[model samples]
Target: MSQNWKFFKESVRHFWQVGSLVQSSRYLVDSLLADVDFAESRLIVEFGAGNGCVTRELLRRMRPDARLFSFELSQVFHEEISSIAARDPRLTAVHGCAMLAAQMFAAQSVDCVVSGLPMGNFGKCAKLGVLSTVHAVLKPGGHFSQFQYSLLDYRLMKRHFPAVRLGYTPLNFPPAFVYNCVSA
Candidate 1:
């Protein structure tokens, strides 16, 4: 089956985890990554990397030496990204939860984190847990970029990052608000 078909099927079956019925648009992906300093980002992590859409884009923009660790909870999506990783030496496809990020990497070691996680679908504690993991793994001035269909997580992000900037991409299926946060 095609990637979109797989994504649609998975989203329908696991809306709360997958978040959207389709993969993000290029416009939305670009907006989500707009603030990343690709040149300076040597180690990057991507959460909720569905079907390697954003993963491919990240690989395209990253420096030849940069590394990306993509985490996906779904077996189907993880398999898809694993295939991409087989072709790209710089990518590591992780079949696990985003909350395990800190365990996988050293504290204050990651340069950036691009998240497509459905924070709005999670309860307050789950949200805080994931945010804390991201914060802990990120360098002092590392970037944390996330996107949500709604603005519900804006204040939550602000609480985690000292600096948070919001951007919009109306071209996506349901549109999305991108939060570019800098870890303190």
Candidate 2:
């Protein structure tokens, strides 16, 4: 199945987890990753990597020696990422939760985190848990980029990161607001 079809199917069956019925547009993907300096980044983590859309772009832009660990909660999407991983040695497809990031990697070891998680659908505690995990795993000056359909999590993101920059891409299916946060 095509990536879009797979994403739509998963979103229909698991809206709370999958978040969107459509894959991210190139504009949104670019906007979300604009702040990441791929050349300087060594270890990158991607959360909620749906259908490997952003994963593919990240791989394309990253340094050859850099590593990406993509975490997906959905089995179907994880399989798709795993297939991509098979071809790219720098990619590691992890079928798990983003909250487990700290446990999977050393503290302050990740250079960047690009997340497509539907934080708008998560409860307060769950959002805090995931954000805390991102902060914990990120290096002192690491970047954390996430896209949301609304600005609901803007304040929450600011609370977690020392600095937060917002950008918007109206070309996406539902449009998206990108939050590029810098870890302290």
Question: 1-184, model 1: which lDDT tens digit per residue?
Answer: 8888999999999888898999999999999899999989999999999998899999999999999999999998999999999999999999999999989999999999999998889998989898999988999999999999999989988887899999999999999999999999
TM-score of 1: 0.98
| Backbone N/Cα/C clashes per model | 0, 0
- What's the TM-score of each model vs. the native? 0.98, 0.98
10 residues in a row with least lDDT, candidate 2: 1-10
lDDT of 1: 0.94
Query: What is the TM-score (0 to 1) of candidate 2?
Result: 0.98
Q: What C-alpha lDDT values do all the predictions have?
A: 0.94, 0.94
Residue lDDT tens for model 2, 73-108: 999999999999999999999999988898999999
* RMSD values, in order shown: 0.8, 0.7
Residue 102 miss distance in model 1 (angstroms): 0.9
lDDT of 1 at 5: 94
Error of 2 at 140 (Å): 0.6
Name the 10 consecutive residues with the lowest summed lDDT in model 1: 153-162
